[model samples]
Target: MTDEQPDRKESGFKETTRVRTARERLRETVAGHDRTERVPLDAADGRVLAEAVVAERNVPHYPRAAMDGFAVRAEDTFGASDRSPEILRSAGEAASVEPGAAVQVHTGSELPEGADAVVMIEHADERGGDLEVFDAVGAGENVAPVGEDVESGQRLYDAGHRLRPSDLGLLKSVGVREVEAYEPPSVAVIPTGEELVAEDPAPGEVVETNGLTVSRYVERWGGAATYRDVVTDDPDALREAVERDSDHDVVVTTGGSSVGERDLLPEVVSELGEVVVHGVALKPGHPVALGVVEETPVVMLPGYPVASIVNAVQFLRPATKWAGNLPVPDPPTTDARLDRKIRSEPGVRTFARVSLTDEDGERVATPTRASGSGILSSVALADGWVVVPEASEGIPADEVVAVQDWEALP
Candidate 1:
């Protein structure tokens, strides 16, 4: 761990930082910080609200027909049926209905003035513009009243709310062309390591892929990602790349935060700004690093693919989302019985990937490979992660484990 000898040949690695503290600091660093933009309706999907979206006008602003039929007076239609039908003159489309008269109206068409009810087309017969009503309808039946969906001056969404597709429809219904929302964070993913190759790595070299993977993760987390070239394991080179990427909202570096000989992210982050954490108390992700450089949040992920993915899910994803005031992408959770024993080191929070299946009317979880973090297939073949609390040593077979990141409950 000395400056002269950057590559320390040490066993077990010297890790001093805790995971929870690092996450707490990251939260503090990113909370309530983002720029607002008045984005057009077309580009506002998945963006968080920076201001309340008040209804400019009532949804359906006018009384509209809810069915294709005749708009009539409910009292007039009473006592009218197939056997003893009520006869009335039709006023035609958009025409006002006189007493004992009906107006032709289509679904979603505005109800003619003085019309209080609409009899569906199936319940009424239109013969040469003349109307014969068979079924009676109550006042306001099959009619969308004024402000039926949203009232004018009502706030449809509060600040910090994320916009969905349906939310855009709501705004469009109220004639909102654009909305003020938090801009998505711009992230830079920089992969660092001397042994890393751009592509087609031989036996002695490893392919650099964490940046691409992290860039995609950042994009999925509602951020614009710029994947930077893989910087060699040099403090100056890493520091320069980080400085240049500081224009972005956040920077995520991979493959040099651990206590290994070539791990250099912690030192570079410290020299550039401040290293909030250099290690974590989580298994596989224990080498995750968190920091802030030039007020830009920097997340140094472990070199291992699984570790990088897990830590990205744990830290970077939320940071990117929160920087833009976006909501967290909360995965569905489910509980299942362990199909076999899952072991973990006590005092280290573990995330064991497991594939679950319904066997004998019960959900059974089989553990994935519990080897080194470089094993990507271990997690890819699995459905969800089973959390092993720091206080617990191991979970025995048949024990019900909550799959916190599960897509759905079995």
Candidate 2:
């Protein structure tokens, strides 16, 4: 709350805010929204649970055979061997196993009553209505007892746990039909700029892609995104757009955030609400801004494609997670050796796109040729990006670094 506010009409930031401070303020503004909904198990994957899931019934309601075998009393198979096999009368699928009698059962079949163990068909021989066991069996062997997989009243998952494919399967096995899941945050993605068009852009006119890109990412990050039409850089239109979508959990406007005269999002946002952060000390996206309107967090991204995407990952993603009561997942990463040195500003964090390759016997990361913020292909074709800390000037060649997969979802 104490961060100095940049002048709305200022052309550039004298001192940018740290990435951590911007994120903290953004999270604080959007946190504590606890809306939830009942979601069927089929559609619950990747959703965050709103409450603990308890098993109401055992996974295996009855004791069953784990594999195809003959059910027999443990005592009947004791001392059984190839040289002196123990012989028992065949019960032939009887409802229950009598002492010294064996009942046939298949995999997953209910274990016959009175059967303490199972002798595999491979270890037993059938001869004139008699079964000869050549292997000793212990009680409960080759059988799946009741509650073996999930016991009744067992807590399967706690609040904030993200559901996966296997998690849904297990929940269904325990008689769970649906789950109480946090509702995804709603976002309005508005791309601004007078020179932006939808398609078939002529000279000096750029196709409107920042909104499309940011909206898609909003959905991928577990937010319901309403992709709005491209709004002109006029202050009145920009303010109207923000006010129109203020009901949403978050409002993200891409472009028109820089210091150029055409860049007007920072000023527009200031008029309608308080801008928490005007610029961040991050490479390629320092013009990004964060604000709050009617208790809803607003994220203004840079006009450049790469910078917009980078700021979305840094600010919008976590804000959406906080609003939806979902836990933010760490991006997936891989360790690789840098093929070449990467220069970076000492006081700014940098995300240098790189393509991974195997050279000789080592995994090497080669920086992309088009590393500028406006170069969409640089990030499009890159496998991941190597992060340079604010304290480091550059990473030397052959140094091992963790490459973060920007598109990965947890």
Candidate 3:
């Protein structure tokens, strides 16, 4: 772990910290920050509200016909029946209805000025320049009153509420064109490795996909992501990349986080700023690191695809939520009995990929066959992951576990 000799086997970490400790440090570092911007209602879907939204005007501000019928005074149609009808003069398309007069109106049309109710077209008939009413009408029946849907000055949404598609429609109905919402956290995703290539890779080279995957997840989690190209395993290059993206709310780097000689992010992060938690006791992604540079959080992830994804969900997801003044909720989970025993270390937290199937009218979770840090298909094809806590060794067969859908957006 000395400066002159780079550690090859153990990656300089004498003892890895627990997963809970690492998450607490990261949450504490990036909490209590606010950034807001005005967003149009059309683009406000999934954005968090910066302030409470109050309606400026009522929905359906004027009384209108709720059904296709004739507008008439309620008293004029009193005691009307199918056998003996009340006859009134027909006032075609009248702006106002007088006594013993009926106005022709359609659904959603404004009620006439003097009209207090509407007699359904089926209950009334126009015959020989007169209207025959066969049913009695209440004073306000079949009319959409003012503020029927939403009252004026009503609180639509409070701060930190995430806007959905239906929410935009309600806002538009209340005459709100835009809203003041917290801006999505900006993220700079850097993929670093000497053997990574953009497209066609040679024998030893690998295609760079971690940056793309992580960047898309950032957007899904309500953040803006800037995916960067691959940087070689050089201290100067890696340091410059980290400094270039220090202005972003979060800097996530995939690869170059292990204890091998090529892993140089830990050293560079320590030199520029403080490393909050370097190595965590988490299976398949324990090499992940958390640091802060110029007050912006930097997350160092393992090069393996599965490991990178695992750490991103555990660390980067919550980091963005805290920075944007949004709610950090848990992912959706389902309880299922284990089909077979799953092994894990006693003190390290493990995320075992499992695919669910119904057997004997019960949901059973079976661990994926290729359960390795480098295996990507193992997770892509699985339904969810079962988390083994740091307390116990592993879950025995027939034990129920919560299968967390890790990719579920918050």
- Per-model clash counts, in order, read 0, 0, 1
Residue ranges of candidate 1 with Cα displaced over 4 Å:
1-18, 78-94, 121-136, 360-362, 406-410
Q: Which number leads on lDDT?
A: 3
Which wins on TM-score, candidate 2 or candidate 3? 2
Quality of model 2 by C-alpha lDDT: 0.90
**TM-score for each predicted model, relative to the true structure:** 0.88, 0.96, 0.87
Q: Where does model 2 exceed 4 Å of error?
A: 1-3, 6-11
Error of 2 at 82 (Å): 2.9
What number of backbone clashes does candidate 2 have, counting pairs of residues 3 or more apart or in separate chains? 0
Query: Which scores better on TM-score, 1 or 3?
Result: 1
Order by lDDT, highest first:
3, 2, 1
lDDT, each prediction: 0.83, 0.90, 0.91
Which whole-number lDDT from 0 to 100 does residue 210 have in model 3?
A: 93
**Candidate 3: worst-modelled 10 consecutive residues by lDDT:** 1-10
What TM-score would candidate 1 get against the native? 0.88
